[model samples]
Target: MKIIGFKINNYKSIGSTENFLSVEPKVTALIGKNESGKSNILEAVGKLSFDRPLSSSYLNNKNRGASGEVSIIVHLEYYQSELNEFEISQANTSISFTDNRVVKIEGGLSELLNDDELLMEAIQCVLEMNIRSVWGNDSNRIKSVQDYLNGLKAITSQVYINHSARLGNLKNWITNDYTSKEDLIEKLEIIDNCLTKYYSLLPSVYYREQYPQLEASYKYDDIKNIFKEPNHIFNRFLLAAGITEQEIVEAFEDPIDGNRKTVRNRIARKIQKNIEAEFNEFYNQEKIEFQVEFESRVFKIYILTDDKAMNLSERSNGLRWYISIFVDVLSREYKNKSLVYLLDEPGVYLHVNAQKQLLELFLRLAERDNQVIYTTHSPYMIDSRDITNVRAIEKVEGGNTKVFKSAYNQNLSNDSKMETLSPLVQAIGADLKFNIGPSTSNNNLITEGITDYMYMNAMINYLAIDSALNIIPSAGVSNINRIVSILIGWGCEFKILLDYDKAGYNEYDVLVNKLDETLEDKILFVSCNEEVVKEKMWSNPQTIESLISKDDFKKLSTPYDGSSSSKKLAAKEFHDKVVNKEIQLENETVSNFQTLFEAIEIQKHNIAIVRD
Candidate 1:
C-alpha cells in the first residue's frame, strides 16, 4: 500500500498544509530550511498515529492557549483481489466471485490519523490464519478495513523510532504496564493456579512451589514469592493508580520472607529480563536484533565498560544525543514492526561523514517501506538530488504559518535540476539558457538570426570588452515577440537590433512598449546604423530607390540562384567579411555584433533555407 495524499492543520509551525506523497521512489526527500514546517509535518504524523504528547513544550506552541490540536488525513492505494475470503482461486469454478468482491484495502498510515481498530483485527487475522498459503493459492482476497489496518501496522510501526525524550516516555510506559518482568512470572503462576482451579485432577501439575529450585531458568519459587500477600505486585498496582512510592511502601508489609522495608529490586530486573525475552521472540520473526549496555549492571546482551571507557557526565552531551536514539531504533526494528521515524535534529554532535551515513541508513529504511522524517540544520544531511522536495516553511504576516515550495521548484526549468549540486552562478546560467532570457544586467542585444548571435559573441571577445549584458538571437522575426515577453518578465537589461528595414521597425514597434513597461530601466532601443550597414545584403527595402538600388532588391526577392548549401556558404562569406575589416559594419554596438562570429567562427555546416 502507498500513501497518496495528506492534509494537516494547526500543528506546531504548520498552520495548515496538504501534500501528496510520491510513489515508490528510490528516495523522497523533504527539503526545507530550519523551522520550515518539515518537522511539523513529521510531528503531525507522530501526533496523530503514535499517541505522542501534544503539549506546548513538545511543539513550541505555548501561545495557542495550550489547546491546539493537529489533524491529518491520508489517502492510500494498493492492489487487492476480488474475493472476500483470505484466498479464493479464480481457477475454482465452483467458488466463483465477481470483481466487486475484490478490493485492495489501504491503511490510513499517517500517525496523525490514529485509525488502528481495523489494523488490530488485521494483525489478529494474520496471526491466526495461514496468510502466506492463502495468498499463494490465488484465494479469495477481501479488502476489509481490517486488512488496511493490518497493513498499516506492518508499515507504520516497523521502526517507529524517535529521539531520546520520546523514547524515555515509551520506555517508562512499556516498563510500567506490559514488560514489567515481576508481573510476567506472577501472571504465569496466576495462570497456573487458574488452570489448577479448572481441572481438579491437574492440581498436582499446577503446584509451582513443589518444583525444584532452579537458577538458570524461570523459577516457580520466585513466582510464588513475588505475589505473597502485600508485596511489590500490590504496591505496583498502587503506584500505577497514582500513589506515591513512599506511601505504597508505608502501606504494605513485605509478604515475601516477611520483610517490611526491603522493597523488590528483583522485579525491575525481572521486567528487564522479560523484555529481553520478548525482544528475542520478536526478532526471531522480524529478523532483527536488539542489545544494549548499561552503566549500572550486566543485563541482557550486556556490555561491561571500564572506568576508562566511561566519560564524565559534564562532557558527554554528544554521546547523550545519540546513545538513547541508537538503542530505541534497534529495539523497535527488533520488534519487527514498520514505524514512521521521527528525528529532531539528529546528529547535532556527530561528524559530517556520520551524518551522511545516517541519511543513507534512513534511505534504506524508507526503501523497506518505512517512513523516516527528520529535521536538521546540517547541510551534510541534505540529499542534493532530493532538494526539489524541500518546502519553505514560514510564519505569515497574519500570525499564521505557511509552507511553500521554493522558487527553485522542479518544474521551473531543467536547470533547476542543477540547483542542488552546482554552484549558484552556474545553475543560474543554465536556468537562463533554458528560460532563454536576454541580457541580465543591461539591455539584451536581440538579433534577427543565429548568424547575428554568433557574430555578436565573436565581436565581444574581439573587442575584449567585459560586460554582463547577454545577447540572444531570435531564430526568426516571428519569435521576437516570444523572446521579448520572457526578457520583459525577467526584467533584465536589453537592446533590440533588427534589420534596418520594414520588418525590423515593425518588430521594434510591437516590442518596444512591452520592454518599456516590463523592463523599463533596463531596455534600450538601438537600430542598425543605416549608413554603415552592408547595402549589398539588404533583403527587402521599403522604397523603390534604396541603398543597393531597386533592381538589386528585386533580384534578392527572386528564388535563390543555387542549392541551399551554396546560399549558406554565401551567408557565411558575408559574416567573415564583416569580421575581417574587409566589410565595414555599422555603429559602436554593431561593431560588437560582428565580433561574435570572430570569437568562434561557425564551422562549415549545412544550413536549410526556406524555399520561397
Candidate 2:
C-alpha cells in the first residue's frame, strides 16, 4: 500500500500538518531547510504504519490532552484484489474511521468512537487508569485493562521494522541471548542491561546492528532471522558493505554452502558495477567524479561529480551519510513488499547535475511501480511542468504546519515557475500538457476543446464590428478558468463563450470570482442556446453555408428560404442574446473598448435598414 497523503495533529511542533503526496512517481522528495519539520513529516508517516510514540513535547503545553493525543490520517493507494481503485484513509485519535470499510479494534486507545458518548467514555476510562487500580478486586476494570492490552498488541503487530532506530543493538541482543535457557523477560532484561551499560558511555546508539526479524512475536531472534535471510539483496549488500570481505566469504564458505556466497558475491559485484558505470558516465559526460573508499569495512560508496556536484566532503558531505540512511531505506524497501520511500534532502551532497541524475533515477524507479517519497530544496530536482503537485509547506499560527497548493493549473512552464509558486520558506511536494497555445507567448487564450472555441469564434466574428481578439481551443472545461486567469494577469481581455450548461456555467462563475469581480467588463461570457441553434441554424443544410458565405449584412439579412420572418427572427434573437452579452458594460471600472449592448442595438438598426 502506497501512502498518497497524510496529516498530523498535536504531534511535536506540528499542531497540524496536512498535505497530499505524489505517489505515482515512486521517489517523493520531502525537502525543506533544516528544522522546517521535514523530518517530522517522515516521522508522522512512519507512525501511520506503526504505533510509535509521536514526539509531542514541542506542543505549547505538554500538560494538555493534545500532547499525548496524535491524530494522523494516512491515505493508502493500492490496487484492490479486483484491480479497481482501492484507497483507505486511516486516522488516529479520531471519531470513526475515515474509511468506514476498515475496521477498528475494540478497547483500543485510539478508539473508532462513532458516537459522542463513546468518545466521552473512552476519555473517562483514560482518566481512571491514572488513578491506579484503586479497586483491585474490580473484575470489570481488570477485563478493560486486559482488553486494552490486547488491542494495543494488535496495533503493534501491524507495524513494520522501519519504526525502530536502533538496528545494531537489536541484532547484538539476538545473537547473544537466543537459545539460552532463560525466561523471555529475563532474556530481554539481560539484553537491555547490556545495551544500557554500553550506551552509558556512547548513549546516542539505539537499534540492533542485525536486521530485526518481525513476525508473530517481537522477540529479537524473530527479527534477526528475517534480517539475516539472504533472499533480501538489500540486506546482503548491507552485510557485504559493512563486514570485511573475508568475513562475509567465510560466513557462507563451509556449512552455509557455496550457493549463498555465490549469490552474495554476485549481488555485491552487481552493485559495484552499477555504481562504477554511473560514476564513469558522469565523467564521460564531462561531469566530475567524486569517490571515497572508507578504509574500514563499515561502508563504501561512490559519488558522481559535475558543475552541480561541486564540493567533495565539505559541501556535499561524504556519501556515507546517504549510505547510512540507504541501509534502512533499502531494507524497508524489501521488508514491506509494497513500500513508499520517504527521502528528505537526499542529494544535498551531490552536485546540481548529479541531483538531476538522481531525479531521473527516481523517475525510472517510479516506472517500476515503486512509490518514492522524496524531498528537495533544489529546483533542478523538480519537474517544472508538475508545479501543481508542488505544495508549499510553511509554519502558521500556533507553530502548526500549513500546506498551500496550486488549484488552477497543474502543469507549469519553466518560465512561469516563480509566478506559479508563492515562494514559501519550504514546501514538500505532475500532469498532462494540453498544447492550447505556444509556450513562448505571454498572452494566451484557453477554451473548452477545439469545437467549443471554433463555434465561439464564429459567433464573435459574425457579431463583431472590429476587435483584436485571439481565440484558442482548450482540452476541457476545467482548463478554461486557469487560462483566463493567466491571460487576465498578463493584461489581456478575454471572453469565454461556452454552451449554456451546468459544467460551462460552473466554470464561468468560478473564473469570474477568481480573476477579479470587475472581470465582467473585460471578460465576457457568451452562451449559445443549444435548442435555438438546432431548430434554426442546423435544421436547413444550405442555411449554414449561406450564412458563412454571406459575411455582409445585406446578404446575411436576406433569407435562405426566401422567408422574411425567419431572417428577421434570427437577426433579432442573435442581436438580443449572443451579440448583447459579449459587449455588456456591467463593470464600467474596466473598459472592453465598447459596450456590447450598444453594438447589438447598432447592428439591429442596420439589419432593419437592410430589410426595408
TM-score of each: 0.33, 0.40
Superposed on all Cα atoms, model 2 deviates from the true structure by an RMSD in Å of: 18.8
Write candidate 1's Cα lDDT for 1-612 as tens digits. 333334554555555433323322123344443444555565555443222223434344422522445443444332122122223222211100111112121222223113333434433443343433322232233233235325334433332222233223322322233334343334333323432221121001000111111111213234335445432332233222233444323224345543432333433344345433433332232222222222222111221133223222322344333333433443344323344565666666766545555666667656554556555555555553223323334444444445433323223233323333232212122135433223465445656654444444444433444555455555466567776666556665455555556665556556656444443332222332433233422454421011122232233323223353333233334334434444433343343333322222222132112112
Tens-place lDDT digits, model 2, residues 1-612: 344455556555556334433333244444334455556666555434322323333223221324444555544433332123212233322211222122232221122222224333433443333212221345665554444434323331222122123222222333232343133224334433432321121101012223222111122233245465664433544452343344444434435567655655554565455444443443243544433332222223344555454323343332433333433433343332444555666666665555555666556545534566655566556643232234444444455554433212223333433333322111111111222222333222344543333333435444453433344544357766665656555455445545344555556567666656664443333322223233333233222113222222333333234473354333333333333353221222011212332322224332211111
Minimum summed lDDT over a 10-residue window in model 1 is located at 202-211
Best candidate, TM-score: 2
Identify the candidate with maximal lDDT: 2
